[model samples]
Target: MDSDRIAEIIIAEIRSTVPELEAQPITRADSMADLGVDSIERSEVILATLEAIGLKVPMVQLHGPRNIGELADLLHAKSKA
Candidate 1:
């Protein structure tokens, strides 16, 4: 239930799922548009991240986030709570 751990897992999952991201680190301020993350791809990343941590992420909550950083923050907060 740690924010930093969740962030780390998310970044790792993103890199694993999208091999093109092998060299870059996920950033909080980066937009999904800049990263070429479409809606479906974003969902894939989120789902992978949740699976990695043994969590069942709610699809309804997954609708709006655009990048791993924002999603990580939300998941981290939920974990903490």
Candidate 2:
């Protein structure tokens, strides 16, 4: 899927986990800080997203995309490539 669709899914996941958050688009470069997601939360997100995508990405690969938008972009690119 494209960025917008991917973003919606990511946002939903984040909202489900972080209920206190105001929903935002994961379609673009929204920072991790903007989502109120700290490192611990990101770890959970990493596992969940990987499982959803059916990919076993190395943790190092994930490290670069330190936010939902970046993560989504990375996943999309990886799938496309």
Candidate 3:
């Protein structure tokens, strides 16, 4: 899938993992940290996103994205590989 779609998945996962943000608007430029998601919640979002995209990789390898867009881009690249 494309990065945009992956970003949507990430956003969905974020909303699902953190119900407090259900009414909040999420976009590609948003970061979980800035959204007030703790580290554990962030990991859960990422893992859930990965599962949604049928991706299996080391959690450490999924680091370095500063925002949802970057994470989607990285996940898209990895999925293509």
- Best-fitting candidate, scored by lDDT: 3
How are the candidates ranked when ordered by TM-score, highest leading? 3, 1, 2
Q: Candidate 2, after superposition: displacement of residue 42 in Å?
A: 1.1
Question: Could you list the CA RMSD of all candidates, in the order they appear?
Answer: 2.2, 2.4, 0.5
> Over the stretch 1-81, how does candidate 2's per-residue lDDT look in tens digits?
775666666776666667777555453567666667877776776677667667676777767775667778887887677
Cand. 1 TM to true fold: 0.74
Global lDDT of model 3: 0.95
Per-candidate TM equals 0.74, 0.73, 0.98
Instruction: Tell me model 2's lDDT, rounded to 2 decimals.
Output: 0.68
Model 2 lowest lDDT segment of ten: 22-31
lDDT of each: 0.69, 0.68, 0.95
Model 3 CA lDDT for position 42: 94
Residues 1-81, model 1: lDDT tens digits: 676677787767667767888898567666555776666766777788778777765778656655556777788766555
Q: 7, model 2: CA deviation in Å?
A: 1.8
The numbered model that scores best in TM-score is: 3
